[model samples]
Target: MHIKRVFDVVVVSLAAVVWLPAVAGGALLVLLTSGRPVFYRSNRLVGSGDPTKVVKFRTMVKNADRLVNRDTVPVTNTRFLNIAPDSPLYTRAGRLLERCGLTEIPQLVHVLSGKMTIVGNRPLPTNVMNALLDEYSYAGDRFLTAAGLTGPAQLVGRDALTDSERLRIEGAYCHAVLDGYRLRLDFSILLRTVLIVAHLKPSLSYTEVMDLIARNSGSRSVVALDEHASPRAADNTEVA
Candidate 1:
């Protein structure tokens, strides 16, 4: 457990050489194409806890968050404030930064400060968290550990996943953390995140990622039953 912190520091520090310059370049792009405010701090939830101040590159136009809600985006994304990658809300610079994952560059600071992590469940925007808590009784438990920059959910992405499946994968990761965290497990997720972002490897399917988590979870209780084992026609059930 303690070692994970050390690992986070080491991984983030080594990446800083490039991350600093990349963030700078990204910020310049935002300034040139959009305007002021290179970064913004959001009150994202980290588990079933109070909102933590998380820093992110400003990828949207001014007053963008105020304009969107769970059901208000011009597109059909039902999660994360219902904003899709192609939402018209994003500035020209915003689209590029988001596509490359550079929008989260400032979060590396929180990882170093122990406020966030390198691997765990991804933090939820307040709108998504509130909706989940209202609809799913066990939604809060999806946060067993602190929020991370990338984790099981990010490994598979939001498009290919049903919201229920995404929640289950997050719950499974929390279950593992509640059981015990393995350094090797977190490392693998982090490595896969970089590879996928770099387009070096294709994103894993939910089943494939679940298998990876189950294998390194170091517990018999970490089983994620295959959702595809039997198809139910609209009578679907979510994992707890």
Candidate 2:
């Protein structure tokens, strides 16, 4: 919608104006403490299309991605779910950045550039997206909207929820947008996002989340994927 786009640009531009100084300070801190490469660039697919480089403040040791074995680790609330607290992969400065979410400040550039919105589904890396598609039938529906810096899923549970629960929340969000996009709804989510960033508990409850998932699960537009299927075989399964 025109209003949504206008809202995104206006709100995000104003936010950039307010947060740019913090971004600058954060960058300088990363450089002085960690040395060079103040930002980390990642290829993320906001939708089902080609990947785009998403920038964020570097919050790990140099080449940390290359060193971590993601498949063997446990998921956590932090951005780097696989990197444990004691892991040598985290730089001293990076830990502080992660705690305060300073690492994500650079994504303001994404919001200003129209590559992302202030509120929407979180963008997924290519491999992670593909893996989700393999596991859940409704997973692809998340790509229906531009990815957000924060969203319903993030406010609802984030890394604390299981994979199935996450996909369900995302599917409900996609269904909500498809039904009718609303400025008020976006504003509500944005407010909740601010609270979450402030380290406050969200008002959303487990019952509410499950209710949304149950309501949308049987919708003709959203299909459920087999949780157990391998990537190769998942493509062949019929949508239910």
Candidate 3:
């Protein structure tokens, strides 16, 4: 923990050094194939006190967000689930990038710029962020630290679970950070993440995905949120 920043700089710098070519290649592919910007930036909550525009390879269409607003659904739902393999929004190259996780490669820029870390909670989409704060005041607090490209919850499941469950896992990860367990989990998280990527297969459904994550992360309470409860009181405050 004492060498946290040191570790971040050294590891990420080394990663950038080794992966520079891949990063450049990914960017060039996006530019050439999509004929648009090589990167995509969207506002997300880094933590309770930090808001940032997360940078990643532009995998979707140029105005994909405007066209589909696909970020609102839980990954298990129809918008993403029911999409045909030949959906026009995804280029042939883009589908490969998603499977290989290359689309996320540009986030290294954000990590290098100090807006994110090599490991921490993945940032939330804007609508998801608003929904989160509207339901759980303590949820946005998870973003108080630098956003992570991958973290405890991600090691558990990348695109699984409901919004409320994601919040619970995030909260648990934040608790681990506060309780000084980050160092203990850091290497394990990295190792598991590598394994997951290496074995990338079909998309896991939301429930199955979340269950795996909850189990792996050792979360004791990842219950569903109250249906009728309104968390808007938590929203008036600026998240950053």
Candidate 4:
């Protein structure tokens, strides 16, 4: 894990240099296009017990949370079909950010702060985390490592995946980490992630990747965190 942390620090530092301008531009765009409070901060669980704030460019309207409740869809589900394109809760600027994937750039700060890593399990919303824990036995195992900006699941199909398929991939990743994490694996995942961002599809099917993870996972066992741990509330500040 020490090696992974060192890698994260070095990579994130370099990324900040390259992405700092983009981050600033994104922030300014959000302010002009959407209005004030250009950043949206949410509470996400990192490890089993660590709750950290994840920042993103504010893509939705200030009243979006109240206008639309994400809980309508069960947290364990991978698809968020309820949030349609025509939904009033979604802002024009937010849709563009989502399409270009610029909204997530702010999370580099979390990566630098050690609240997240360059590659690992994607962080879940507090409610989603709790729901998954209640539904799946393997949910806690994913938390054994820090949340990731990009990972196998993201490289696979992301929200296009079914709940079971998502959990399977996540379990495979957790198992791999517990058994043995290597710099090579991280580099491979990072490369694939870049391809994904560049609009290139992965050559391997999601099932193929899952099978690969299973074969490489070895026999390591991962323990889940306490189910009763309380989640922190995210502070939402609206700037006019």
Candidate 5:
């Protein structure tokens, strides 16, 4: 774990340095195109059992949250799916940001600041966290790690699965974490995410998610994730 954290710091630090220009350029585009804040930072719950803000490029209207039609779909889930190659809500520049995954560039800052890992469970919104704790407080152990900008659940099928299923995969990943697992998962996530962004068919399935957990069980026993964990934990922050 120590080594993986160190590796995360080093690799993400370098990414931030090399991509600083693009990050800035993207932020500029958001600012110019949306007439809103360039960066969208939201209060999220991460490991250490506390709240943190996750950052991303602002892709929706500034008042999106207030206007979110919960009757349609949860906002957090929509945020992930909205980036699908066809979502019509994305601003022109937002489409380009999503296409290249540049919207996530701001998370490199979080990696540098020790607030998050390059790869780990996605942070949940504070409301989501409260709901999870209320329902399955015993699973706090799973939430004891820093929130990640990416993770195993993401690698398999983030947008494809229902929120409950996504949290199940994350819970499995957390329990099975060991040396080299983070690196391997991060690499897999990056490759898969890039492929999805490129509009290629993703090789993903529920069976694949189970297979990853099985391969990495490593003395960790599998327990069912709380049914409500996914909806409650959906939320993000910039590097602080």
Candidate 6:
């Protein structure tokens, strides 16, 4: 875990060249294309922590959450949520940022500040997470580690997974964090995330991804994951 934090610091430091320009350019785009409030701040529950004001470029209308969103599709078998690759409410600048993956550049601040990590589970909207927990109380296992920019769940887009599968993978990540975290696993997830952002397929199939996780699942089982019983843990502290 300590080493993972060190790695984050080192990597974020080296990426300053790209980070500075990207963040400035991203913020400028939002301001020029969209109106005021170039940044979006929302209280989100990340890992086992309290609600935090997560930062990102504003991607929707000023009052998007207050309006009914028509672009989201419900997650299969879960009465709790709707997710989508694109939303009708997204502003033009927002869509461009999302496409370029610059919408989250501000979040790098959290990573540098030790409030978040480069790879881990994502923070959930209060309503969405509440609805999820209302259905499956065990989903809380996700709080076991720090919130991530991307992780196993992100490797497979949301629509491709069922609610159970999502929960299972999330819990698996948490389990890995507690006992299975490894540097190699962290880089593997990072690489996979890059592939996805580039709109390229990962060299590993879904089964292979799951298998790699299982192989690294350490003995320090802290949570109950998997639809069957035990889950595959992270070989390294994957999302911390």
Stretches of candidate 6 off by over 4 Å are: 68-80, 203-206, 216-224, 227-240
Q: Output the worst ten-in-a-row residue range by lDDT, candidate 1.
A: 226-235
Tens-place lDDT digits, model 5, residues 136-213: 434355465677777767666566765445656666667656422445555665566657656684656755765665
Clashing residue pairs in candidate 2, if any? 137-224, 137-225
Local accuracy of candidate 3 as per-residue lDDT tens digits, 1-240: 345555667777877765688788887887777777778888777766545678888777787777665353453321112334467888766887876767677787777777777777887666666655654566675675667888756654634544445555566555555544435455556666767777854334434433544444433443232223322333243232
> What is the TM-score ranking, best to worst?
1, 6, 4, 2, 5, 3
Give the CA lDDT, 0 to 100, for residue 86 in model 5: 63
Give stretches of model 5 more than 4 Å off: 69-89, 132-142, 178-183, 199-203, 216-219, 222-240
**TM-scores of all candidate predictions against the true structure:** 0.88, 0.79, 0.73, 0.80, 0.74, 0.84
Candidate 1 per-residue lDDT over residues 19-59, each given as its tens digit: 98998899899888888888877788876678887888899
Q: Give candidate 1 regions above 4 Å deviation.
A: 71-82, 224-240
How far out, in Å, is residue 8 in model 5? 0.5
Worst 10 residues of 5 by lDDT: 231-240
Error in Å for residue 198 of model 1: 1.0
Task: Give the better candidate number (1 or 2) by lDDT.
Answer: 1
Q: Between candidates 2 and 4, which one is better according to TM-score?
A: 4
Highest TM-score: which candidate? 1
> Model 2, 97-207: lDDT tens per residue?
777766777787888788887777887777667656655666887878788877777666564655565665676666666665667666767776677767785557534
Each prediction's Cα lDDT score?
0.77, 0.68, 0.61, 0.68, 0.63, 0.72
What lDDT tens digits, residue by residue, belong to model 6 across residues 1-240?
Answer: 898898789878998999889889888988898878999898888867679989988888898866642224443455335535487788999888887778787898999999988888888777677666666667788778898777787777666655556777777777886786777777778877788788786545445556656665562452334435432332121121
> Which TM-score value belongs to model 6?
0.84
**What is candidate 5's CA lDDT for residue 124?**
70
Higher TM-score: candidate 1 or 6? 1
Worst 10 residues of 4 by lDDT: 231-240
> Candidate 3: worst 10 consecutive residues by lDDT?
222-231
